[model samples]
Target: MKKIITLFAVVVGLFAFSSCTTTDDNFQEDFDTYPYAFEIKNVDLGRVADNEYNLRSTFQFEINDNLRDDETVLIYRLTSTINSNTPVWQLIPRTIYFNNGDLVDYFFDFSKVDFFITARANFNLLNRREYIDDQTFRIVLIPSDLAATMDTNNYLEVMNTLKLSENQVKKVKL
Candidate 1:
C-alpha cells in the first residue's frame, strides 16, 4: 500500500511539471514602434517677446511622453514646390542669407510635452513678414539609436527609413 501511494504522488508531480512545461501558442513578440512624424502647414510665427525681434511658435508633441534625453527632434521647412507640386524640404537650423547681407536662422527646441519653433536673425524681422509668415514645417521624432544609422539631411532618405507615407504623416495647423 505504501508503494502504491508513492507511485501516485510521483505521477501527480509529473503531470504538474508537464503542464507547466507546455508552451502557449498565443504568446506574441513585442514590437517597438518609436518613430513618428507630423507636418504643420502655412503657420505664422508669433513674436517671442514684446521687445524681442525673434519670431516663434509652440507645438504640442504628445508622443514625447517617454522621450529619452538622447532622442532626436528633426525639423524641416517646405522650401519650395516643384512642377508636379512636389515639396522641396530643407532641414532646419537653416540659415538664409538675404541679398542685403542679412541672415535669418530657422531652428527649434523641444521638451517632453511640446516644442517651440523659432526664427532669429541679425536684423529685425518686424517689417519682414515674408520671412515669418505662411511657414510650413515637418517635425520628426526618432530614437537616438536609429538616428545614428541614417543620413538625416536627406529628407527622402529619412522618410524611407521610417517607412512613412504622406498619408501616414499627420497634418497639423496652428
Candidate 2:
C-alpha cells in the first residue's frame, strides 16, 4: 500500500511538470500597429448570362516591417453601387487569410445592373479606405440566353493588377 501511494504521487508530479512546458514555435503574436497598406490587385467580372453574373477579385496587402512579425487577419466587405452616387450600398462581407494567396469570387443576379465595384479590406479591426473600380462596359443579356463572352483584355487586366500588387508586397521583409 505504501509503494502504490508513492508511485501515484510521482506520476502526478511528472504530468504537472510536462504540462507546464509550452512551445512557442507555432504561436503567432497579435498585431499592434495601425494604418496598414493594402491594395486591390485584380478584379475579374465574368460575362453576364441569362441575367446572372460571376465576379472574382484578388487583393494584395503588405504589412509594414514593424508589424510583419505579428499574425494579421484580413476581413473584406465588397459592395456594388450604381452611378457612384447611391446612398444605399449593397454589402457582401468575407474573411480571408492574409498569408494565404486566394482569390475571392461571387455570383449575383445580373438583372440588378451596377456600374461600379467597390472593395474594402479590413485588417486587424482597422477599416481601410474603400477601393472603387469602375466598370467600363455594361453587362448585356445574350440574345441566345447564353453566358456573357469572356474577354481576354478584361482577364489580362485583372491578372496584371494582382501581379503588380503581389510583387510590391513580396519585397517587404522583417
Candidate 3:
C-alpha cells in the first residue's frame, strides 16, 4: 500500500508540472499604440448591365479602429481610370472623379465605426458595343488637417487602402 501511494503521487506531480508550462509563440497579448487605423470592407458593387446607363450601387466601407479624438477628419476620393483611349471610351473620360477631396468631420463616440460612403459610378456602358471587359480604378481615403485642403488635387500623406480592393468595372452592352 505504501509503494502504490508513492507511485500515484509521482504520477500526479508529473502531470501537474507538465501542464503548467505554456508556449506563447502562436499568440501575442499586446496592445496597439495607434489603435485608430481604419479600413474599407464588404464593398459589394454587383455586375453591371449592358444597356444600363446609370449603375448606382449603395455600399459602406468598414473602418477598423475605434474613435480617436485627433482622427476626426477624413477626405475620400473615388475614381476609375480607363486603360485604352479609344474614341468611344473618350466620350466618357478615363478619370471619373467622385469627390472634391474635402475633409468631412466624422462624428462617432466610440473608436471603431462603419463609415458609410456613397459612390455613384456613372457607368455608361451603352455608349460603345465594343466594351472593355474590365476597367480598373482606385478609392483613396486619407486623413486631412484642414477641410479646405482636401480637394481633387489635394490629399494627405497617410492613407489606408483596400489591398485587393481595386474597383473593377465592366463595360457591357446589349
- Residue-level lDDT tens digits of model 3 in 1-174: 999999999999998765644223332212122222232322332333432222222223233542234344342323332444311111112234436532211111222443232222344434432232232222333223322333423322222121111122212121
Cα displacement (angstroms), candidate 3, residue 153, comes to 5.4
lDDT, candidates in the order shown = 0.72, 0.30, 0.31
Which candidate achieves the best TM-score against the true structure? 1
TM-score of each: 0.71, 0.20, 0.26
Write model 2 residue lDDT over 55-170, tens digit each, in one string: 44322222233333222222222244356553122223323335644323322221212223323232311122122232222221111211122232242232232222222322
Task: Give the CA lDDT, 0 to 100, for residue 78 in model 3.
Answer: 30
The superposed Cα distance between candidate 1 and the true structure at residue 170, in angstroms, equals: 0.5
Count: clashes, candidate 3: 6
lDDT of 1: 0.72
Clashing pairs in 1: none
Residues 17-113 of candidate 1 have per-residue lDDT tens digits of 6653322233221113433688888887888742223334444544555566867889888888896559999998888988989888887777776
Q: Which stretches of candidate 1 lie over 4 Å from their true place?
A: 1-35, 49-61
Candidate 1 lDDT trough over 10 residues, lowest sum? 22-31
Top candidate when judged by lDDT against the true structure: 1
Residue-level error in angstroms, candidate 1, position 16: 30
In model 3, the runs with Cα more than 4 Å from the true position are 1-32, 35-42, 45-66, 81-111, 120-153, 156-174
Q: What is candidate 3's CA lDDT for residue 24?
A: 37
lDDT of 1 at 85: 54
